[model samples]
Target: MGGGLPSDARTMVVYFDGNYVDANDAKVSVFDHGLLYGDGIFEGIRIYGGNVFRLDEHLARLELSARALMLAIPQSRAELAAAVCETCRRNNLQDGYIRLVVTRGVGDLGLAPWSCANPTTFIIASKISLYPQEFYDNGLSIVTVPTRRIAPDALPPTIKSLNYLNNILAKIEAKQAGALEAIMLNAQGHIAECTADNVFIVHQGEIITPASSSGALKGITRGTIFDVARDIGVPIREADLTRYDVWCSDECFLTGTGAEVIPVVKLDGRVIGSGKPGPITARVLAGFRQRVLVEGTRI
Candidate 1:
C-alpha cells in the first residue's frame, strides 16, 4: 500500500484493492504481473449527469476481457459495478471519467500468471479532459500511421488489455505527424481504427465502419452510435474499409468512451466530406448526448 503521503494532498478518493483510499495512496506492487508482463484488463467509463453511462455494458466487456486473458477477477460483476458507483460517490463526481483496472497481483519476475495468487483491483473517478472545443467545432485531422493493428489471431482487439504499446506507438506517429489522432490498418492494410477510438465513415447517407474481424475494438461508444443510427433510420453496416474508402467517403468520424463522437475533417491531408462535420454526424452526435443523459445507471 502507498504511504508517507500528505492526507489532504489528494483531492479524489480511489478504490485501492478492497479499501477506499486517498488518490495519493493508490499504489500497486512493482512486481505486479500487469506491470511486469501486461497481464491485466481495464475499462474506461464515462459519467454523465451523475450517471454512469452503460455501466452494465462496460462491466460485461471487462468480464469478456478477463475471460479472454484467462484472468480471474476477484470481484463479481455486481460487486464491481457497486464499487464503481461507490468510488464516484466517494469522490463526489457528477460528470467525469472512471478507470477500472484489474491486475494479476504481485508475482515473481516471470511471464507466467499462475504464480500470482491474488488480483489487484482499483477504481479511479475524476474529471475528464475532453477534446478542445475547437477540435469539436472545426473537426480533427488524422493521419494513417504505419503501425498496423494486431491480428485477431495473435491478440483480439476486443479485449481491453493493459498491453497497449501497439496503440502508444501509433499515437506517437500521430503526434509526430502533427495530427490529433492516427488511423491504424489491419495486417492486410484494411482500415481498422484510430489509436484509441473506433473509426466510421458515411457515404451517400449510409454509415459504415470496419468490422470487428478487421481488428477493431468493440467500443461501447461505437455500439451506442450504431443504436442511435438505427433509431434515426440512418443505414449502417460493418465492412472491411480501406484508405480509398475513407478518401471517397462523404464524412468521417471516431467514437470512444473518451473521444465520444468527433468528426474527422482530414485524413492524410485529404479533406473529408465538405471539410467539416456532416449533417448525419451532427444528428448522431446530438442523439448520443441525449441518450447518455437519460439512459444509464444513476450514480
Candidate 2:
C-alpha cells in the first residue's frame, strides 16, 4: 500500500529492526502478530531542548510492557536508548516526538504466540503538533463517552500495548459529540482517564487524579505533574473520581506525552470553574515547561 505522502514531504529515516531505513522502505511482515493480533507494546517520548525528556522512565515503561506480554526486546535498555538518540540525530531533531515500538515478530495465522521467534523493534522521530494555542489559553471542552475503559483484569491499562481500539472508539464518540477528547470510566463507573491522556482535577485546594487501579495508564507526564505540583506548593493525590467530582471541581486538566498539560474549561456542556484555565493549572503548566528544558538525558 502507498504511504500516502505529500510529494514535498521530507523523507524520514526510520529505525527498522536493527538498521535505519528510509520511511518508505521500512516494512514489517503482514504475518507479524503485532499487526494481526496487536501482540506488542509501544512508548511515545518527547525531546525538548535537544534532550529526551524522561527517557529512562519511558524506556522502563516500555520494558515493563514488553515483559507483561512475554516479549523480549532485541536490544538492551542502553542500546535502545542509543538507537533513539541516533534516530533523532539523523533527523536533526532538536525537539520532536519519538515512537518506540516492539512487535511480536512474523508468525503463522494461528493464534499461538509461541510460533513467533524474534521480536521486531523500530523507532520513529518526528515533529509534534500540540493542541491549538487558543485551547491552551481558553481551555478545552470535552464530553464523557459511552465506551468505557477495559477492566484491568482483562487487559491491564498499565501495559501500554499496541491494542488501543478501546481508546479509538472513545475518540470516535468524542468527535461525534463535537469534542476533542472523551472521558472513559472504569468497570465500576469511576473516572479512569481520557482517550489518550490522564485526567486531573483540583478540588478544594488539592490536585486529584484517578488512581492507577482505576484503569488509567501510569503516564510519565502524570508523574511529572505530581512533582510539578509539589514544586509549586500544590498538594496532589490519587483517588477514585466521579463525574460529579469533576463537575464540582475548581479546575480540570489532562496530561500526556503529546498533549503535555492542557486545561478543561467545560465538560458535558457544563462550564468548569470560572470557565477558564484556573490559576493552579496555569502555575503547574508553566512549571512543567521549565522542568522539561532542564531534566532528562541529553541527546
Candidate 3:
C-alpha cells in the first residue's frame, strides 16, 4: 500500500540532525552506527486534524527505548516536539504519519556504542496506509507463522530498536502464505503479537489480549483501545493467550499506529466468529476515531 500521498509530500521539509532540510537532501553517514549495527530507536506517530495523537506517550516510549540502549538523544523532548510540529507545519499537512529516528551516530566497524560520541536524529512526516481500503471495509485474513517471537529475556520487546530482521522474516512468511499479517507466538506458545501490531480477541463478550509478559510491545494504539473499551463499557483484560483461545474467541482485532484498529475475520483459513467484523470491533474503532481528532498535542 503506497498510502497515495499527494505529490506535495515528496517535496516536504524534514528535520535532520538539528536542522530543517529538504527531504531529498537530508542524509546520514554510511558509517552511522544505526545503519551498520542497528543501534537506535524510533517512533511512528500520526497527526489527525493537526493533532499529533499521543505525542507525549510516543515520546515517553521512545525515551524508554533510548534509555534501554543507553542512547542519549541530542535534543530535549520539548525541542523534539517543536521540531516535529514544525516539520508538519512546513509541509502544510493536516494529517500524516511521523517517523522519529535517533541513531548512535557515525562509528567505525565496531560493536562498541562508546565509539560513537554524537547521535543522529531525523524526523519525517508523511502519509501511510498499512492496508487497502477494502480490507478495512471487509476485514483482514492473517496467519500464525512458524517464526516465533524472540524471547523477552533474550531481547526485551519493550525496546523499539532498529533491528527488525525477526519481524521482517515473519512478514515474509505471511506474504508467502497469502496473509496480510502474521501473528507471532512466544517460545512458550503463547500469542505474543502481530508482526507490527498488538492483537486482541473478544471472548464471551469480554476483550482479551496477551499480557505484556508474552513479549507484546506496549503499543500506544493498543493502550488507547483500553480507554475506548472502557468508555464504551466493554470489559477488557490481559492474559497468556494461545492459538486455541484466538480460534475460539468471538471476535478478533489488531491495533497499532499505522494499522490503527482493524478487524480480523479469518485466521489460517478458519473463519472468526461469522467471518465479519464483529459489533464490538466496530464500536471500538468508532470510539478510537472519536478520540483521535480531539485528544492530542495540537501542532
Best by lDDT: 2
Cα RMSD (angstroms) for every candidate in the order listed: 2.4, 1.2, 2.6
**lDDT (Cα, tens digit) per residue for candidate 3, span 106-223:** 9888899899989999999989999998888799999999999999898899999998889999999999999989999999999999999999999888999887789999999999
- For model 2, residues 25-45, the per-residue Cα lDDT tens digits are 878899999999999999999
**lDDT over C-alpha atoms for residue 54 of model 3:** 93
Worst 10 residues of 2 by lDDT: 1-10
Segments of candidate 3 deviating more than 4 angstroms: 1-9
**TM-scores vs. true structure, each candidate:** 0.96, 0.98, 0.97
1 against 2, candidate with superior lDDT: 2
Model 1 weakest lDDT span, ten residues long: 1-10
Check candidate 1 and list the clashing pairs: none
Ranking by TM-score: 2, 3, 1
Model 1: per-residue Cα lDDT over 67-114, one tens digit each: 998889999999999999999999888998999999999999978888
CA deviation > 4 Å runs, candidate 1: 1-9
Top-down lDDT ranking: 2, 3, 1
